[model samples]
Target: MPEVLDARALNRATLARQLLLDRADLPVLDAVTHLCGLQAQEPQEPFVGLWSRLRAFDPAALSDLLTGRRVVRTHLMRRTVHLVTSDDLLAWRTRHDAMLRQRVLGVYRTELDGVDLGELAAAGRAVMADGEPRSMPELARAVAGRWPEPGVRALGEMLVAALIPMVQLPPRGVWRVKAGVRNVPVSSWLGREPDPPAPDGDPVGETLVRRYLAAYGPAATADLRAWSGLAGLPAAVAAIRDELVSFRDERGRELLDLPGAPRPDPDTPAPVRFLPAFDNAILGYHDRGRIIDDEHRGLSVAGERVVLVDGRVSATWTVRDGVVATTPLRKFTRAEEAAVAGEERKLTAFLSGGDDQPTA
Candidate 1:
């Protein structure tokens, strides 16, 4: 019989893997790679994500990585923008192409109807071939005359997000800097194209399964699909099944995990953690019952910043005039309140540039 793990055990394992049990002493680049990537639809949120997970994380270091081309903000997993290492982008983009196109079409099917996708892709490449950064609207206008039926928003979204692999360049995501998105082809920005898909077996798919397990393992295939928005990884999982260990969840669903991955004890104490909007730690699984309650599940996708007490979401937090205000989802014990207050103070200091007046 596969070892049966309960929800608390799963929560502890998730907290450990997500670096929420304790802050990891790792460099910014390695941390980004380890988490696979930080969901970056809200540009500044990733800095906070890193701040919570890493020790003494310097936002400037992440900014430098962006300006230095070691990292990029691009559309990936779940057709959302993510802050990913350039190497992961190169290695993973091709595998995500079909899903990207399908998602765009799902949103803009009528507008994109009667359009030859291949030709539209060619025109988009031609427009971007000049090596100049362009906004989505601008790129769309440059080719809209040829496909006048589809409106600019529809055409532009498909072209910029799905057809062409593009990076949102700095200072769009630079630390403490605000700028509108300006896109350049990933190939031009990275000085090389994304890796081509294989003719035979799914190597990229296999890599994704391994990487997902490494970070969010002891997970079901449904959990993996939910995290990635990829419907096609079961084959990948099947191909590598022998290499993984399986366990049964309290629900009787089989969970797959990397052999040596940490599955911490359920009684292990977890500290107060402040997570940014859409933190993968909460959003990365199909069944989030392990870390968040069903009643509160909407909070994660709704983009509310949350506070974790004892490895489960306990409160929602927001900042107002340098004060971090927290609203409890449930009544907290005295110790939990103190831990949350202490962590919020640190978060406020981090947000307010080390100012001592950060009240919780």
Candidate 2:
């Protein structure tokens, strides 16, 4: 019989793996890969995500990665812009290609009716083969002559998002820098081609499961599905289940965790940590009640950045004038406020590049 771990046990395990229990001494590249690529749709959010997890994390290190072509911002995993390692983007992109295409088409299938997808894919690739960075609209307009009636918005979205493996160019992800998205092929950016698709079943899927468990485990198959947006991973999980440890959640759902991974005591002291909007540590699971309250669970989907007090969300936070301002979702005691403010000060320094700032 699998031991049933309650919500608090799951939350502590999550915190330990996510590096919130204690700041990890991991390299930036490893950290990005570990978290399955920070939810980077908002561009600057990954920096905060890293800062909260790593001790003395420099925003410039991430910027250097972008400039060095070591990391890339691309559409993958649920059709969102994630700042993934170049190696991961290469190894994992091909596996996600079908899902990416289907998702984009799901939104624009009506708009793109009668379009020959094969010819469109060929033309889009031909256009991107030139090794130039082009905005989605620009790339779409360039191909609009052939697919004239598809509308530029639909065409551009399909090409840049689904058909092509393109990286959002630098300055878009540069530290404290603002720039519009311009895309170049992943091949052009990294000087290497993407990994070929698995000859049979997805080998990459198996790897994804292992990596996910190492970072966020004691998780169920549903949590794995929610995190990757991949259907039919149960086979992958089942294939590897013998290699993993099994437990049950409070709800009796079987959970799989890495054997050597941290599962701290439920009563372990967890300091206050401020999470960025769309932080996957909380959002990656199907049952988020382990780390967030049921009533406030909607906030994660809504992209509201939250403050974790005693390892559970007690407030929401936003930035104004480089100050991290907290609004208590539930009234906090003085000690909790002090802990939150102290952590907020650290967050402010990270955001402001080592400058001391007030945390209101």
Candidate 3:
């Protein structure tokens, strides 16, 4: 019989892997890589995500990484913009190509019915070859004459998001800077194309499996698919099955993890941490019952910032008029309330660049 890991055990293990149980003394690049990239659609939210997981994390350093092209914001992993290492964007883009196309088609199939995708891709590349970044709308308009049948929105989404591997340029994802997205091919930005897909046994897929497990382990295959938005990893999982350790959740679902990955005790302490909207710790699972209650599960997809007390989502947080405030989902003990307030103070200080502020 597989050992059963109940909700609390699963929650602690997740927190440990996510670097929330203890803030890691790791560089920003290393932390970003380890987490397999932060979901960065909101742009500013990743700064808060990194802040909660890393000790002494300099928000400027992440901005530097973005501007320096060591890290990029691109569509990957669920067809969403993520702040991933340049190398990861290069290595993983091809693997995600099929999924990306399918997702776009899922949204715009009727609109693109007669469009020749290959021809469209070539047109996109040609327009982007000018060595300048263009927004999705701008690029779409440039090529709309060629395929006037499809609307610019459909054309641009397919071109920028699926047909061509592209990155959102700097000052857009830069810390505290608000800018509209301007995109160029991933090759134009990185100076190389995506790594060729492995002709053999899905080497990139295998690597994704390991990386996902290392960061989000003791997770079911369904959870893996949910996080990645890829439905083609069964072969990769089979290839790696012998190298993994398995346990069952209380719900009788099998969970797999890297053999040496951390699985902390359920009774282990979890600090009060405020998570940014769309954080992976909540969205990365098929079953989030480990860290968030079923009734409040809608909050994750709704993009609410949440406060975790004892490793569970216990409250929603927001800033209003330069003050941090939280609304509780459940009752808090006095100690828990104190801890949340203290953490919020630290967060406020971090957000405001250590400026002293009046208590909320």
Give one digit per residue, the lDDT tens place, for model 1 in 1-360.
999999999999998888888789889999999899999999999998988888888889999999999999999999999999999999999999999999999999999999999999999999999999999999999999999989999999999999999999999999889899999999999999999999999989999999998888799999999999999998999999999999999999999999999999899998888999999998899999999999999999999999998899999999999978899999999999898898888888888888442222
- Per-candidate Cα RMSD to the true structure, in Å, reads 2.0, 2.1, 2.2
Candidate 2 accuracy as lDDT: 0.88
Query: 1-360 in candidate 2: lDDT tens per residue?
Result: 988899989989999899888888889998998887888999899988888888768788999999999999999888888999999999999888888888888999988999988889889889888878899999999889998888999998888888888899999988889999999988889888799987887688899999999888989989988888788677778788789999998788989988899999999998888899989998789999988999999999899999999899889999999888899999888999898888887787777777642222
Q: Write the per-residue lDDT of candidate 3 for residues 166-270, one digit (tens) a residue.
A: 999989988889999999898888889999898888989899999999988899999999999999999999998999999999999999999999999899999
Q: Kindly report which residue stretches of model 2 are placed more than 4 angstroms away from their true locations once superposed.
A: 355-360
Candidate order by TM-score, decreasing, is 3, 1, 2
lDDT at 297 for candidate 3? 99
Cand. 1 TM to true fold: 0.98
- TM-score of every prediction relative to native: 0.98, 0.96, 0.98
Error of 2 at 342 (Å): 1.1
The lDDT for every candidate, in the order shown, is: 0.93, 0.88, 0.92
What's the residue-level lDDT of 83 in candidate 3? 91
lDDT minimum window of 10 residues, candidate 1:
351-360
